[model samples]
Target chain A: MSRAALLVLADGRFPAGGHAHSGGAEPAVAEGRIRDADSLAAFCRGRLHTAGFTAAALVAAAPHGLDPLALDEAADARTPSPALRATARKLGRQMMRAARATWPGPDLDALARARPRGAHQPVVLGLTARSAGLGPEDAAHCVAYETVSGPATAVVRLLSLDPFHATAVLARLAPELDRVAEQAAEAARQQIDALPAASAPLLDITAEAHAAWPVRLFAS
Target chain B: MSVHARARLRAEPDGRGSTALPVLESAGPLALRRTRSPRPPYARVTVVGAMSAPLNGDRLAIEAEVAAGARLTVDAAAATVALPGPRPDADPSTYTVNLTVGEGAALHWLPEQLVSAHGSRLHQTTRVQLAATARLLLREEQILGRHGEPTGALTTRLTVHRAGRPLLDQQLTYGPDAPAGWDGPAVLAGHRAVGQLLLADPSFEDAPLPARLLGPTAALTPLAGPAVLVTAVAADARLLRGILDDAMRELLDGLKA
Candidate 1:
C-alpha cells in the first residue's frame, strides 16, 4: 500500500481519456447554469454527492477480490443514461490500457478478455488499484476527487475563469470529498445490492442532450 | 394513524383470446378496478385510493403479473400525495410495487404523478421483471411540492430486470435530508418536477432508437438491453408531462414502425 501509488492514480494526467468529458459541465455551461465559481461550486457539490458518490462506491467495491463482471453489470444498473454508459466504458478501456502498461497483471488481462468492449471506468479503476497494491479507500478517494477535479478543470477551460478560483473551489470541497469517500468505502463493504444507487436526473438528461449536440466541446 | 394495504392483480388470455383479469384483489386503501380497454386483448385496470393513504408509517404494496400472450395496462385515477402522520415523530411511509410480465406478454404501467406535500416523508420503490420476449412501458413522475409550498423528504427507487438480468436501477432523493445541492444546477436545478418513461420491446434489439433530445430538458437514450429511457424535469408537473408525452408519442410510433 504505497501512498505514492494513490497520488499517481489520482493525477489528472493519468491518460484515462477523462480529458474528453466535462462531467456534465458543458451542457450546464451552455444553459448558463454554471457561470462562475459560485455556480460551479453548487454544480460540483450536487454531482459529487450523487453521481460521484455512486461511482466512488463502485470504485471501492471493485477490489476486495469481487467479480469485475458483476460489478460492471451493477455499474450499468446504476447508470441510466445510455450516453453516459458509453462514455464510462470508453473511459474504462482507456484506463485499462494505461493500468496494464503501468502494472502489467493477469487480472487486468482476464478482465480485458472478459469485456472486450470495456468495463465501467470505476470498476476498472478499482482493479487498477488492486494491481497497483492500493487499498479500497485509496481507490474511493481517487474517484471522489476525480469527480470534482474533472469538472473544475473543464470549467477552467470552458469559462476561462481565474484558475486560482477553480482550484479554490476544489480546496473548499475537500472536507465534503473526504466525507463522500469515507461513506462510499463503508457502503462498499456491504452486499452489492445494498450499495448506494444515488442518481442525478438532470445530469442523466443533460448528458443525453450533450451527446446529441451537433457541435460540442466535450464527448459527454 | 398507519395502515397496511395490499393489491394483487393477474392478467391472462381468456378463452375468447381477450385479456382477462382472473385475479384482482384490493385491500385497505388500495382499490383496483377493471376498466374497458379500447384495444382488444389488452386488459386495463385503474387504481383508486379509497382513503388518504401512505401516511407516515403506512406500508402499501401492489403486485401485478401478466401471463404469457396477455396484455395489460395499469393506471391511477389521480396523483398520490404523501402527508405526515398524527405523531410529531413519525416514520416515513413506504410504498412497494412489484410487476412481472411473462414471455410474449406486454404490460403498460402509466401511473399518475406522486406529489410530496409539506411535512411528509415517503419512500417508494418499484421493481419490474420481464421475460426475454416480454414488452413493457413504465412511467414515473414526482412532484416535489404542491402549489406555493415547500417540499417534504421523498426518495424513490426504480429497478428493472429483463430475463433475470439487471436493466436499470436508480434512486432519487428530494426535499429535506437529501444530499447537499440536490436542487443545484447539476441535479434538479431548482426544478420542482422530475419524471422518466421506460419502453422496452424485443424489436429494439434489432433496431435501436438513436439517442436524441426531445425538448430543452428531456432526452431519449437506448439502454444496453432492448429498452429506451426518456428523462425530463420542469418547473411544474404539466410541463414535465408534456415533454414526456411528446417523447412517448414519437417512441410509440417508432415501435409501430
Candidate 2:
C-alpha cells in the first residue's frame, strides 16, 4: 500500500461529505458548553477516546478481508443514535462513490450493491483502504483522525474559535491519537464482536438534538 | 438472598391484552405486582420490595414475555436504593432482566430510578429480543449516589435484537474512585447521573423524529438499525429525569400505534 493512500483517505477535503457534520459540537456550543478554542480541544479529546477510538477500530476491522456485512451489523449495534447512523451511511455512500471512481474495485462495487443506501462510514472506509491496498492500521489512523478533525475544523467556523489554537490542540493530541489508532488496529484483529464499543453519550445526544436544528451549518 | 419474578402476556381472542398472575417467591427481598391502567389496552407490572432486606450480595432477576400481538409494560414501584452489605468491598448486587417480544407485539419497560449508594455496587443487564414486526420503547435512568457522596460502582449492559439482526449492544461501567472511566468527556465529562431512551421499530427510519430533545444536558444518536437512541446526563437527579422524560415523550408521541 502506498503511504500516499493514507494521506488521501485521511484528508478532510476529500469528497467524503464530512464537512457538513460537527462531530456533535453544535449543541454543546449552542448550550454554552463549548465557549472557546480550549473547550473545543477538550470536546475533541473526549470524542477521540470514545467515538474516535470506536471508529478507528471499526475502520481497522473493515480492511481485514472479513465479512463486511457482519462488520456493518457490528457498527449498527455499536451506534446508539439514529442520526449518527444516518450520517455514517450517507458519508459511506459518498465515500463509496468517490472510492469507486478513484480506486475502482469489485469489493467497493459489491458493497454498494448490497447496501445501495450505503454501509456505515467506518466499514466503507476500511474496505476503501483495502481497495487502496492499505492495511488495517492505515485505515484506523484515517478514522481516528477523522473522528476529531471534523469537529476541530467545524468549531472554528461555529464559534469563530482560533484556527491556530484548534490545530495546536490536534497537534498536542497527535501522540494520543497515534496511541488510539494503534490500539484500535490491535482490537480489530480480534473477533468482530470484540471490536471496541466505546462511545460518547454526549456526542450521540448532541447529534440527535443537532439533527433537529432547522438552521445549522452541518447536516448532522 | 436470591429472588426471581416472572410475568407473561398474550393477546386474547378479542384482541385485548391478558396476562397470567405474576410468579414470585415469598422468601426473597423483592415482590411483584400486576395492575390494570384504568384504561383499555394498557397494563403494568411493578417490582416492589417484599421486605426490608439488605441489597448487598443479593441477586434479583426479572423476566417478562409478550406473546404475539400482545403488550406489557414493566415499571418499578419506587426508586431502589442499593445498601452496602456486611463487607463494603464485597461483590455488588445484581438485577438481570430477560425479555422477549413476539411477532407483532410490543413491550414498554420503564424502570424507575436506581441509586447506587455509597459503598454499594449494582450490576444490571437487560437483554431483549424482538421479532421483526415487534416494537419496543425502553427507558433507563440512574443517579450516581444517594446524597453528595460518590457512588461505589454501577454497571449497565443492554442489547436488543430484531429477528437475527442486532440493533443495539453496549455497556457502561462507572465508579467514583475510578478516575479513568468518567473523567473523560464521552462518559459524562464530570456529571454523575445518566439517562438513556431507545425506540426501535422496523418503520423507524422513515418515521419522523422529535425536533429536539428535552434540555441542554442531553443529546441523541441515530442508529442504522432503524432505531433512535437518546442519552442525557446531569449532576442533579431531577434534571436528569426531566431530560429523559422529555426525550421519551418525543419518541412516543406519534410512533405509538
Candidate 3:
C-alpha cells in the first residue's frame, strides 16, 4: 500500500494539470528572480515554508472519517482569487479522476459530486488520503512533497536542468519535507478549523498579467 | 477649532454634506459608515457602524470599525479628480483612512477610479487591520489625466497590518515635476493609470497563478520572500481597461491556485 501510494502521488503524470504550472517559476525566471539550479531550489524552499506549510497542515488535520464534500467547501471558502480557484478545481477534478480509477471508492465519488461549481485541489487530496486509510502524518508528508515537488519539477522542465541535478534538489529538500510534515502533524492534532492563509498580492497581480499574455507555456 | 493652516480637499465623498457618521474631535473611539451602488462590471459595497475619527481643521481624520458581515462598495458619482491647493501652500491635499475588521467579519472596500488633473498634487494613505478570522477584499484604480492632457503628480502610500504585523507595504510617487521618479522603469513606465486589488484570507493556502496573465507592457516580478509585484504602463483608456481586466481575473483566480 505504501509503495503504491507513493508511486501514484509522486508520479508527474498524475493528471492534476500541475505539469502546466511552474508555480510562479516562469515569471520569477522572466524577472530574473531565479537564474540557476541553486536559486530554483531556494525558491522551492521558500514556498514550502509559506504556502506549503499551511496546505500540509490542513491535509493532516482532516477529521477522522470526515466527509470529502465538507473538506472541499472548506477549501473553496478559503481561496480568494477567481483564477487560482479555477486552476485548483481543474487540478482537483483531474486528480479525483485519476485517484478514482486507481483506488475506486464511494467516498471519493460523493466528494466530487458535492463540490460547488468550483472546488479546490488540496481539499480533494486530503479526502482521498483519508479514504485510503492513510495516517495523518503520511497524508501531511504527501501534501508537503507535492507542494514543493510541483515547482521544483516545473523549474527543471522549464530550465532544462539535468535530471540527476533535479533529484539532488529533491534530496536536499528532504529535511525541510520532514520538518514541514512534523509541523503539519502537530497542527492537525490541534484540529484548528481555520484554513491556511497568506496575503500575497503581487502573486495575484502577476497571475492576472500572465493570463493576458498572447503566448504562455503554463496554464497558471 | 484652530485655523493653523488652510486645508485642501484631497477627495470629497459623493455628496455635498458630510457623511452620516459624525466626524470626532479627539482620538477616542470613532464610527464611520459609507454606502454606494456597484459601478458596472464591479461588485457593490456598503460600510456601516461606529469607527475612529478626528477633525483636523477643514480636513477630517477618519477610522472605521468594520463589523463582521458588513459590506462596503466604494463608488464615486464621478471620477475623483485632485485639484491643486491654493497658492502659498507647501503641503498637498491629503486624506488618511484607517480600517479595522473584527473576527469572522468581512470587509469589501471597492472605490471608484481616481483621476489626477494637471497641476494637482495629492497624498493619500489607507491602512487596514485584520483579525485572525477576518476577510478583506479591496480594489483601487488611479488614472493620471484625461485624454491628451499631461499626467499630474500624485503620491500614494498603502499599508496593511494583520494581527499586529505588517503584511503589505507599498508606496508610489508620480507626476511631471517628479521627472526622474515617474519615468523609472520600475515605477510607472510613463503610464497614466494604475490599479491594485488585494484580498487576504487566513484559512487557505496561497493559490498558484499562471504566468501568462501578466502583460508584456508591464513587468510582473516577484519580490524577496513570499510577495509578488506587478507594474505596467497604460498609454490610454483602452490599455487601462486591459490592465484592470487582467488584474481582476487574477485576483478572483485565487480559488484555482
Candidate 4:
C-alpha cells in the first residue's frame, strides 16, 4: 500500500466538494449546540461514530473489488437525509471527476459511466483508494478523518470560532479517528450487508432542516 | 394477534375529461376501511382500529396503489399504539406499507401518529414506486413515547423509485439504544416529536422550503425529481405537525389539484 497515496486521498484540499458542507455543524452552531471547540469536538465525536463510522465502512469496503452499485445502494440506505444524499451525489460526482483525472483506471471509469450523475462519495472514495493502490484501512482513515475535518473546517467559518482551537479539536480527535477507522475497516471485512448501519438521526434531521435555509454557507 | 390493511384506488374517465374513482383491494384488520370524499378531485380513506394494544406478534401491512390519472388521499383515524404483549418476550410490531402511483396519478398518504409503548419496538418499512408523472405526498409521523415517557425503538426505512431508477433511499433508527442518533445536535436535539413529509410534483421547486418561519428545528430537502422533503422535531407534536403543514403548503401551494 502506498502511504503517499493515503495522503492524497485524505487531504481536505484534494477538492471533492468538501469545502461547501458543514457536516451538520451549521445547524448545531445555529442551535447553539456547537458554540466552541469543546462543543464542536463533541459534535464531531458523535458524527464520527455514527455517520462517520458508516461512511468509513463503505469507503473501506469499496477497494476490495466489490460491486460499486450495490455499495452505492447501501450508502443510500444508510443515509436518511435527502439533503445529505444530494450532497453525497454532488460530491461523488466531483470526486469522480478528480479521481478519473488523477488515477485513470477501469474501476473509476466504470463507476463514472454507470452513474453519470455520480455515485455516493464514500463509494467513490474507496474506489479511488483502490486505484491509488491504497488498502481498506487507508480508505477508512481517509473517510473517518474527513467526517470530522469537514465539520471542523466549516465551524471555523460559521462561528468565526478560533481556527487554532478548531485545529486543536481535530488534533485531539486523532486517536478517536484511528479507533473509528479501525472499527470501520473491521466491519468492512465482514459481509457487505452486515456492515455498520450506525446513524445519527439528529444529524439527519438537522441536515434536512438546514437544506431548506434560504441562505447558508454550506450546501448541506 | 396480527392485523393488517390494504387498499388501492384508480381514477378513470367520468365522460368528462378525467374523473375515474378508486379500485379498492383491502383485507384483514383493514376490514374497517371507510371512505368519504370531502371534495372533488380527491377521496379520503380513513383507517381505524378498535381499542387495541399492538403487542408482540402483531402485524399491520397496508398496500395502496393509484392507477393512471386517479387521485387518492389516505388518513388514519387514530394513532397505532404498541404495547407489551401478553408474553414477556413478544416480538416487535411490524408495519409494512407499499404504494404505487401510475403516470399523472396523485396519492397523499398522511397517516396519524405511531406511538411506541414502553418496552416495545416497532419496525416499519415503506416502499413507493412512481410512474414518470406520478405525484406523491406521503407523511410518516412518529412519537417515541407518550408525554413524559421514555422513547421506544422504531427502525424505519423508506425507498422511492421512479422509472426504474432509485430516487431516494433512507433508513432511520432511533430508540434509547441506537447509538449516537437521538442525542446529537444533528438529529432530535433532545426533542421528542418527529414528523417526515415527502412531496413529489413538477410545480415543487428543487430547493429548501422558505421555512425558517416554521422554526429552527424544522428543515426541508429538495430531491432531483423536484420532490420536496421536510423533517421537523420538537418536544411538542402539534408544533412539529404545524411545521410539516407549512412546509407542505409551501411546496404545493395548498396542495390543490
Best by TM-score: 1
TM-score of each: 0.97, 0.81, 0.52, 0.78
lDDT per residue, candidate 3, B128-177, as tens digits? 78776676766666788766687666666666666654555554556754
**Candidate 2 lDDT over residue span A1-220, tens digit each:** 8999889878888988889888887777787777877677777777887778878988898787778999899888988777788889999999999999889889889999999999999999999999999999888988888888888888899888888988998898888888988999999999876676766667776777777779988787
By TM-score: ranked, best first: 1, 2, 4, 3
**What is the C-alpha lDDT profile of model 4 across B146-202, one tens digit per residue?**
888887777777778776566666556677545543455655667778778888775
DockQ of 2: 0.37
lDDT of 1 by residue, A7-73 (tens): 8889888888888889999999999999999999999999999999999999999777778898899
- Provide the overall lDDT of each model, using Cα atoms, as 2-decimal numbers: 0.91, 0.76, 0.57, 0.77
Candidate 1 residues B91-198, lDDT tens each? Answer: 899999999999999999999999999888999999999999999999999999889799989999998889988888888999886888899999999899999899
Q: Which sequence of candidate numbers ranks them by DockQ, best first?
A: 1, 2, 4, 3
| Error of model 3, residue A193, in angstroms | 5.1
Measured by DockQ, the strongest candidate is 1
Weakest ten-residue segment in model 2 chain A by summed lDDT: A192-201
**Ranking of predictions according to lDDT:** 1, 4, 2, 3
Candidate 1 chain A: minimum summed lDDT over ten consecutive residues — where?
A: A62-71
Q: What is the lDDT of residue A34 in candidate 2?
A: 76
